[model samples]
Target: MKLEIAQSTPTAASIAMLVQEHYGLSEVVESEFLRRSFNQVYRLGLTDGRSLVARLSAERPRGAPNLQFEAAALEHWAEAGCRVSRCVPTAGGEIAIEVPLPEGPRALMLFEHLPGEFTGDTALDIEAFARGLAVLHTAGESYAGPESAYRLDLDYLLQRPLQGLLRAPTMTAELRPQFEELGERLQAAILALGELSQVLCHGDAHGSNNFIQIDAQARREAVFFDFDEAGPGCLAYELAVYPWNLHPRTVDGVLSDKAAQQWRHFISAYREARPVPDADLAAIPRFMAARQFWLLGEYAGRIPVWGSQAMPTDYLRRQVTMLRKWETLELPL
Candidate 1:
């Protein structure tokens, strides 16, 4: 059940207490905040000299389904020969501990710390992601798990966000019509994208989500973690995030020769597993646009915790610039 949540960041000290009390993890040698996005991640070192990663996920008014889906998804991925952070259960027989948020109670799940760090040059790792994504999509097709709380369908990705932005006080009248029209165009493109392949996607598949592990044999493996946003979605849109994330640092331009060359490698690697259809390629821009709008809506939703400064008053303007840049991108990647 959802309860009224107030805007507050869970402190490291308070989270450590929950870890000790609920998870039976005591004698914390050290604890430090890793980063905060959808979840507030912390690194905890123990007296036994073991380290664990704790995630305080009060980002949304989420419940059991969220954690359960993550557990199931991670297990599935791990079994399929990819490395994933396995979920740690609480001492009293729970997969997640309920930590109170200012607005409500949220589930906190501990994970085994995976070794290694994210690498800058991911040529081999990108290939791994491509192949791994194909395997994940296949496994997800036959998954018989309970219904997950997360879904990346058009409603979740586009329509809901479209409504949220319009409802937001931050949305200006000049921008309102533009967003509405853009939303309509994207929606139509999505519809015209008829029969696009669908599967469970690692909703955020950027570099930060995975790690580079070199085995004793000197073979490198790309280990993907964080199943928090994994859910069903169109394959093209899922694939689009790879380039979508690489765009901001675009040296030449989104469609420049340099950018195209960089994106082409990932797409080629992906085809080795399951090739993208011609129609899907044509719809990449629309999906990319959807991701931009969806993020804007997401920022609007997180306004209370992130505040106007963090999310900013000019968030819409930034998004417009972002979408325009994305539009300049070519479909033949």
Candidate 2:
């Protein structure tokens, strides 16, 4: 499958017909702000003064069939007053729509837009965000979706060590050595660790994927978005991402000193929400290292395209440097 990352911008007029057909809305308009990420998000306007979100898949088979699980989870969360975007169900209770594309039929799902500001690098409420994540982790705890058995399994890490390894046509010869070295090191480290602790994680629970609701008085609360990656997984695996996701310093490129500082605030807030088990706590450094290796390996895969850009070059160089630095950190765990 040739996966071209979706960057095509859809207009309101093009989506109006689809929204009206699926949602039975009398009127629909294109959203003003488009979120550019893995998938393109559009703000949907309706005649009844209500708004919804239209998530369009950039590839064919329009939407992944498994995404229905996300709709179910969102429905569950919204009913519990979690401020999640509500999946717009069809009259027969379906939340996903299959749209035809050049490669194949793509999947599109609609959700009621929750009012709030997106919490990115600056002004994110870590404490509140952690609490909300705890709430989500505990939601439908007993309900194991299709990925239940593989929740804590190492298959993804085992089989898919790194992807997009040679996308860049201009990768330097010296960089090849570093990429292969990192990939091998990551695979070995993850394999050495036995079965990991299992938990329902928000999968990609990072700052950008979350929204913060501020009251008239300026008080704030956090709400999670983007359940595309949500599923059962190792608790530590999920927590391990905080250092890179919410910390602006790390985004510029990998930086051990910044990651070290961010982990404290992130973990403290997360602990306040839901205590980390002693076993996972002991494995934080290993998990952190694993996370770094995984990140570097991923970038290596995309080096062909990403390597052409200056930002990715700096980022990759920094990551290579940071991984070496972390080796000497002597984490308490």
Q: Which candidate comes out best when scored by TM-score? A: 1
lDDT of 2: 0.60
* Least well predicted 10-residue stretch by lDDT in candidate 1: 249-258
Model 1 pairs in collision: 4-103, 5-103, 6-102, 6-103
- Tens digits of lDDT, candidate 1, 193-271: 6888777888877666878777899776666777777787788788877777766632234555555665676688778
- Quote each prediction's TM-score: 0.88, 0.77
Lowest lDDT 10-residue stretch of candidate 2: 57-66
Q: Each prediction's Cα RMSD?
A: 3.4, 4.7
